[model samples]
Target: MGFLPITKEECEARGWSQPDFVLITGDGYIDHPSFGTAIISRLLENRGYKVAVLAQPDWNSKKDFMRFGRPRLGFLVNAGNVDSMVNHYSVFKHKRRTDAYSPGGEAGKRPNRAVIVYSNRAREAYKDVPIIIGGLEASLRRLGHYDYWDDKVRRSVLLDAKADILVYGMGERAVVEIAEALDSGIEAKDIGWIRGTCVKAREIYMDEDTVLLPSFESIVASKKAYAESFALQYKNNDFITAKRLVEQYAEGLYVVQNPPQPPLETLELDDVYGLPYEGTYHPSYEEAGGIPAIKEVEFSIISSRGCFGGCAFCALTYHQGRQVRGRSKESIVKEGRRLAALPGFKGYIHDVGGPTANFRGPACKKQLTRGGCTHKDCLYPAPCSQLEVDHKEYLEILRALRSIEGVKKVFIRSGVRFDYVMADKSDEFLRELCKYHVSGTLKVAPEHISDRVLSYMHKPNKRVFEEFSSKYKKINEQLGLKQYLIPYLISSHPGSTLKDAVELAEFLSDNGFVPDQVQDFYPTPGTLATCMYYTELDPLTMERVYVAKTMEEKKMQRALIHFNKPENRELVRAALVKTGREDLFGKLLRGSGRTQNPYKKEPPLRNQKEKTRSSGNRGGQPLKKSNKRRS
Candidate 1:
């Protein structure tokens, strides 16, 4: 069965009678956990509301309305995209041939009624419906935004998608409240007062109006200008420039995001705890008919919302906020016990993590009295000179989790913030983490190696990561554990030019790391990075630097991390030469002088049987019935 099994027939059958609500989903690709569509759909079903999902639907089609035929109450249209960046901005480059189909043969379309539309195309389709577009894609882009792929600044999705209201962040609580309001006979127009949502017309804009039309002639042109613009607005926390751009270019643009989503009760594992979880490296191996040798099978449960660490390039903090709300320890342990009882339980628990796994407490104790620490980071320039580090309660939770009966090894696989762990009052927690929780490698985010780049990204000094890595390694060795630290690094952030990338490459080479992976920075909307990309100035310092916007430049810097590898040497070497850096090309890349190409592979199989096997082995399309929503 797929994540949330609500079919068109089910809805049509239910629509013949009165039901409390109906959920309509625009799930592009399914199976990803980040999308809250599945959970919300299931939650409503659990609450006795007859719900049906329109998975990976063509929201623009009139026939797609059968999913919500003459519903008695409200219609929820959710563009299952996890973040507004993906929804407002386009990333169609990755679209495949099979991306156009909907599950169950498109039979679940909603019927035209005064039904609510939560999908992004509300304005273009079902225009008169009580449209409510809520999700990261609509929430973050609820105002005018710089569309990276389109190379133009566009109006808010609420305004553009023409949804009457835009909901942001986790929508469970807000949606439930909306259901109650609608059930009580309140008009959809009255929902503007709901927190964590934005509505047009009724929601007044008190923020300044500032709008600049991005050059739309070429993505390269917009990328070039946007890259420069992003560097300027990053970390400045000045809404003035953005507001000005909106007012000037998009006079009618406005957004209303009430308070952030209050943290929900930790998810009960009762439903998913007993399911067969296959933890394969590939995100969708099982649905593709491939069985992995090492499956880390367990449900990923989110314990909190938002991250306190205000990394400039990240849009999470901007939407989820720095404040964190945690699930009760009992709820977490209950889920653990349930999972331990699953049929596929192998005594190995895959992970228990969040945005930053270990940050389980409030940002600071002074939050209630002083309204939280306005400071961006606690360990950045110098360890928050006045802050207190507490890991006692947090560590207790971990220890209690390990004590669960059937759980053999409970791992913390989420990217853990090293600075936070190092600052804990005692190494006891670290020791416990090493002794019971870890499964060899710990994933951590250092992001970059250069001080300038780190500062521009609003990250802690490289020294902090170094210190944490050293301590973690020593502790592992002392415990006689055979494990390694797998560090995650990114390239081509707003201020990270080729020079910075080169320095990062050199650092990786010096440290004996072959640089196995690198994430090329993509401009995500509602992020400081997007502004920097457009403006090219340090959002705070008004500083400018060389911005790499070309595909060639991106490939060169991306390959720089893997230049030493034989397979990538030629492509990387050629890129270096193209940059007029032939000197470093030969030095860093092998086979540069010799014509022999070590990276070359054998010719394609011409044998009939081999070809047939290869063709048969191709990964099958994922189950389209999935209710999972991905941005």
Candidate 2:
């Protein structure tokens, strides 16, 4: 229930000569369920293991790794809850100024590739100890993956780190199995059959039931092969139907990824969440203002896991898969009471949701046994008729939380799938959401408005969003409550061209919505969209797609979303001219007619007639002659 030992003095104070496992991480040690290191270490301790944490250790030398004095079990390493590359750099590959996971919001606390660096250091400190790698970075890069930062395909993290084993996904089950095997005298290299793990093999020794993907050489040699390999990897991620996948590397070496372990059932998930977490950063960080990351999730409850809404731009499908699982309502309410009892209880429970807020059970009954459909998405193009669309259990849980004595309001900050809401035959959930849960502005991701772009993103069409918007407005009107929908949009996603950007801009203008923040498509590792960004071909269809790779084009695409801003006039104008879309130039300029141009020097105009035409047009609506004054 207390904090794990992070120093030798603490270990000695616990009357222990040595710890069982020295868990190393990139982020500062925050003993909270929201942190992967906290959950795994606490689970190990609960199972009668002495776990010492070495968080954000100095990666330059082996001295820090030796502080634990060689754990009896082994070393467990992770790049924290987020990928190291993403944590260190922005989507633009620029260095980030702050790390919420570090003390004092400092940068450069960990190395660029922390897992690889830490594992090699552990080897140097203790030559015979087993090293295991897990968490988001290792899980997503378990196989050869396209690294956007490096602009090339990199080998598996296991290979680069030279670790004995790699446990991918939610690794509670895998790590326990690994510990038992290791404690029973099984060597790390010899233990290869465990589920949700990846190990390097010296030769091809897989059984008939295993699936073989394209060799690393072949994928690196041909983009088509890489796409094909990724498709196979994506399809075989389900626990019920997945098979062991093997990919060959040079000199007869192979990386074997065992089938993913089954998702935890209601009771198992409840037990996992009920683990005794200190619920905040370690006291040592108090002097440096603590880990800022804990503030977001300090009072929130993760009620569920996995998402059926498979967006190409998201990595959840590859990491968590498509099956949905939830804890019992009793478990969630108990956590809510605990949150309400915290010292700074504000009577407001920040969130009671996970990957997707509204999802309570599996997408459909068939998925319980058959796993998700390999050929089709659960909620893309359209919701499957077989999809189970109900929010009864979720509503009940929310009601129970609200009834708790100290609880005032429970807000669902994690996004709800609006399309899923529209799929429901009843409006009870929508009404309750607007009346009780909304924090004035509900944030939802519609990504882009163009169906061409949406199709590539594997998101629901624009019509679905429109339907949801209308229903939301009607409910608000009926309740006499004023709430707004803040939609999250993306620019320069694969299959988006200047024409598509213009279409999305027109949609935003019509809706009178100017997003304060816009997300340019970032091609992180292991997502389907990242594959498309690197290959310029949809892995599913093998069709060529347009990609805006140039900085100027991407800036223009992002600028189009906020075309009403005076500063973005020149970028919008350049985009229109380059795409031969001069007709849209008039609409962009006239949408919010302003006199002051932000450009220091005026560029030459096309002609007097062009200027006159632009002044008279108001985003396709004819302006009165008296209102035709130019800036």
Candidate 3:
């Protein structure tokens, strides 16, 4: 079949009595590697299992779920690449106008808490089918986590969706294992021994290898217990040294999570990405102008997976794990040559990066064998002494890609770790990046300026960003390039006081840098920052953190970034007055006269990886996504 069967007719064309699996998704079907639904479906098909695709089915009734009837094995459900709630709503809890994952960039195509709704619908369609749920939404909500929308602790998605088993993290390995066991006639509830899976149980024989977290009732009853629970979940994410973790929901009921599956090695990652992908959206979606999300990755190549650049608001720790993995250069080059032959092959290759572009390998040699240190981060308060910051392999891969027959330029659009760049003694990689990779402007996330806020965000201090800026400027000057650095900053993050927001505004004013996009702290699930947002205490430190909870304060904090804008004068004034820094208000707001604004217009972004659109949440892709929410 050109694409996986999305209808009963297509399934019949495949000459199969029934599909072994029906993969339900919230996104328009685009059989690309960046999509989790594609990888799992193709992998199952390659393994000789009949897999059918069901993309964004109507959720009002069970009619759409009956398109393929019941699968022989199970129903694999995912809430697209992004969390449905985050996709549908902004940080201000306002509804988003459009969705990139849907055809025609439409909104309301998928329901909120899509995994739960789809799972329930699947049950209504087939009362006795084995339902398996995984993806960014399901993975992050595998256990009891802070639900930002509900404003409280919600139980595991496994419970809410009534799923038989929940597969967390990258599901390539665990998915196959589950399929084999199910094919062997094992019940979903009994197939709980596999790694990277969570299953419900009535009783457990406690052992030294099992770590029990505080019960859900205890957490809901006490914020201290909730913080402690989050801390324990944070520490056991490593594959090598992690043990079985259990969370109690009721007296006899429990959710048991096995240790994470190991990261895929070079050849393994190559096989996963080397599957037969149709590249573009399914032909049926052409009438709707195709998926807007595919535009970002159609010309791009994923060279690696995983990240060690620990940020508090990021969900990578729970999903991809900290151990990084890279595909072989040969595999990447092969994909590039194939992309070059495609009908819409352009002269430029968009990106050749993954979670973190420059991280082609593990943080250090020790991570491969012993795993990351549970109590320490690879790059956070400071770069670890054992960090290996060589970028030779990544450079070689980029060179090979750009040298392809039809390739003109290769870009690294997935973002880079500038702190890691500074850790390297030699500036060879920096020089090359400035010379070829940068498209006039390189966007990097500095998150916040104040050391007080930076501590809570797990980002490097302001001085580190300043030094990197200086080095970047010097390197570009030597290369005779007119490049600029777009620093990504956040507002209203936990522990960010009015004084700290004023400090950030002052820094932006002094540097003549007016950022068009400012992210108010979005409290998504399975993040340290989200935990802090709910508990008002740092999960790791258990110290009380100041949270900007009120809507007025969040708006005021965001207004301070662009204080010179005439529309933001009143909010900026309020922020300054609240911080008791009224003395500098005259200097900061001096240009708020009838002259309209004082800042000059920025130069064209020149087909750069990202730019500050009219609204970062709409129109096109945003520049720096500090939070990692991929399946």
Candidate 4:
């Protein structure tokens, strides 16, 4: 019912000489379900296992790792809830000054590649004990992946960490199975048949039921091989149809990944959320200002897991898969009531949603038994005819939360899929969302306005966003609410040239919307966009794509999104001239007199052949210009 043991004193208080499992993490111990370490540790405890948390251990030596001594089962390691590379460095590869998951928001608490470092330390402390690694860092990098920080393809984290087993994805099922197997006298390396897990193999035996990806050497030597391997991994993610995958390394060494574990049913999901969580950071960290990451999730309730809205830049599909799973309405309402009773209970609940907020069930009935379509997306290109568009269950859950005692307001802070909302025939959810969930402004991601770029991102076209915007305005107007829409946009994505950047700038200008924050494309590991960025070819389609790789070009693209700002005028002008759109420079420089002439004369237009050659030399091959701007 209280916090888990983190030190030798706490372990003694529990009257245990050695814990059954020692969970070593790179984050401050926060007993919240939102934290992956908290979930796994608590799950083991509930099953009568003596679990001790060794959080943010001193990796320079084995001293801190020896605090818990040796565990009866094994040592479970994770790089906290986020990938450590993302937590330590910004998109520009600059070292971040602070870590929100650390106490006092301090940086350098955990070293680079925390999983590998901690695993090595654990091995040093007890040479023969089994070491297991999980969490986002290990999950996405279970196989050979492109490392953004290293700027090269690296071998599986399982091989590099020298850990016995690597559990990927939402790890509740996998963790329990591994624990049970280990308790039954099964060794770590021999227990390779479990789902959602990867292990190193010694032979090249092949099975007709399993899939063999490109070998590590081949993938490293050829970009095309890497793309093909990633495409196979992407398709075989669903639990229903996924096959065991094998990747070969040098000297006939291999890495074998089992199929993903099936998504939890409603009752199973309820049990995971119903664990006894302390719901706050460990008391020892109070003097260090506690964990800053808890502030965002303290009052929020996660209603669902997984996403069906496939975005190329997102890694959710590879991590959480495409199936949608939700907890019971009763479970959510109970959590909301418990949150209201917390010491600093406020009238507002920050958010009540997951990956995509409005999703309450699977996209269609067949997905429950057959899994998602491999070649097509549910909501991209266009909504499939079999897609079920209903938000009644989600709406009812929100209504129940609104009626809870001491609850004054409930906001949907997690993103809402506006395109999904538009697909519904009934407007009840939209009307009520505008009436209650609008906290003055609702945020949505219409990442870019160009059709060409949208295709590459696997996002809906500009017209879909325009239609959703119009519908949202009409509903807000009908309810007499002055709610504004704050759209999130991205810049310098693969297939986005200087011309596409200008098109997006014009869209923002015409709408009189200035984004407070703009996201430049970051090529993280295991995403389709990252593949395109690295190879200059779409993994799904082998066609060449233009990529803005240079710092100067990326800066110009980002500046164009905020062209109205006085500081960005020069960057915006330079972009327009470079793209052979100098005519738009006057429009961009109209208000700011920083340039010599507000209305610069336009140069003579180049011939079609000349324009083609000029644009091809800029980044990659030139894309066909489309005039389908949002009206």
TM per model? 0.76, 0.94, 0.94, 0.94
**Window of ten residues with lowest summed lDDT in model 4:** 622-631
lDDT of 1 by residue, 1-631 (tens): 3333345455445443434444555543233333455566655665666655545445455555544455555556664443322322222223222221222223133221112243434334444456556665565565556767676676556655555566666666777777777667787777766765666552254543323333223223454554533332232222111222211223544444344445443343323222322222223323544322123223444444556666776776556555555666776676677767768777776666566677665566664344344434655655565556666766766777778887677777655667777777689878878778777666677888899888877787888878887888788889998766666666677787777777776677667665333566667677776677766765545567556886556655666776665444544655655656665653566533345443443343356344322221212222121111110
User: Which digits, one per residue and each the tens of the lDDT, describe model 3 over residues 540-619?
Assistant: 88999999998778777877877776556666777787788987676677755434232333233464222222223321
- The C-alpha stretches of model 3 lying farther than 4 A from their native spots are 591-593, 596-631
lDDT of 1: 0.54
Enumerate residue pairs that collide in model 3.
none
Q: Which stretches of candidate 2 lie over 4 Å from their true place?
A: 590-594, 597-631
- Residues 284-355 of candidate 4 have per-residue lDDT tens digits of 999999988888888889898888888898888898888989999999999999999888988899889888
- Runs off by more than 4 Å, candidate 4: 590-631
- The candidate, 2 or 3, that scores higher on TM-score is 3
- Candidate 2 similarity to native, TM-score: 0.94
Which candidate has the top score in TM-score? 3
Q: Cα miss at 515, model 4 (Å)?
A: 1.4
**Where does candidate 2 have its weakest 10-residue lDDT segment?**
622-631
lDDT of 3 at 278: 88
Candidate 1 vs candidate 4: which has greater lDDT?
4
- Give the local distance difference test score of model 3: 0.85
